[model samples]
Target: MRIFLGWTLFPVWSGWAVTGPKEVTAKQGSPLAVSCSYKPGYELYPKYWCRPGFLRFCFTYIAQTNGSEVTVTQGRVSIRDNHTSRSFMVTFSGVTTEDADWYSCGVKRRLWFNPQHSMEVMVSPGKAGARRWWRQWQRQHSRVCLCLCRLPGRGERSHHRAGIPGGVSLGELHVPARR
Candidate 1:
């Protein structure tokens, strides 16, 4: 399994932050879940999951937790917010190519919205060849793609910059492949 960490720092906003994977790759027809964490101050605010619209600052809400623990489902998409955890989770069941797009997890504010965290969800064809290519690439460039040298008990202390091929940075966190 492949794991991607989306970590970004927004200089424009203070006291507000969103954390999640910067990008997620899911196979078409499979279920995908993306977890987003927000600042504790916004725990009581309504949490929302939305697709970014073409217009700047416009978002189309797919579903929201509406300040409750109940899971809200809209079609194949579902969103649940856990105030205790200061986070929310969005899940898509039977994802399709049409589902591939940019999504945001945000807190609804009185005057504005704090959709600080956004992620690109890519729905791939799930072809065997593509999987093979990814595995081969990971194996051949294991040092660059992912730094296994830092693993516990590896006895190596090299700090490899964490990033993926598309120039997306995963910050300082080392994401290990799922066995």
Candidate 2:
């Protein structure tokens, strides 16, 4: 005898989803990109934004179907459509670490299955030391010693006597107490 599964017995459809941004970076202010993808034919109809298992923020209109843009939070949050590839480009400028969370992109189609995509947006504050060192390093190799100090802060003063890479010399750290 053959047994059948409930879901398999009925018509089933397949939808596509994305999890991460194609490219991401953490700047002085936190910014995030919510990614989404589809399998075509499932036109990004009536696309809706949500907080995942929570509430729906906005829904796209037919006029905005092919392309649309929405601004939120005093223009801090915005969504741009990439009709060429059927992807939504959502951006959050001046974002903070607390902005990290799961966002949902819901799509409606003829199929009752109703497609949905989600991505976690993580915004991290720029690494202070790393950024400072990187900026100094870009100026000139002679400033590398200063870059090192930025990384280790006051502790690096002692290591300054250890010499820097590229055979560059650094001044010694002299403490009157040690003398």
Predicted structure with the largest lDDT when compared to the true one: 1
**Candidate 1 ranges with C-alpha deviation above 4 Å:** 1-11, 14-16, 54-56, 127-179
Best by TM-score: 1
Where is model 1 poorest over a 10-residue stretch in terms of lDDT?
1-10
Which ten residues in a row are the worst by lDDT in model 2?
Answer: 56-65
Candidate 2 local accuracy as lDDT? 0.49
How accurate locally is residue 25 in candidate 2, as Cα lDDT from 0 to 100? 47
TM-score of each: 0.61, 0.46
**Tell me, what's the RMSD of every candidate?**
18.5, 11.0
Count of clashing residue pairs in every prediction:
2, 0
Pairs with steric clashes in candidate 1: 6-21, 6-22
Q: List runs of model 2 lying over 4 Å from the truth.
A: 1-28, 54-75, 109-113, 127-179
In model 1, what lDDT does residue 25 have?
A: 92
For model 2, give the RMSD to the true fold.
11.0
**Can you write out model 1's per-residue Cα lDDT over 142-172, one digit (the tens) per residue?**
4444464456655556645554543334344
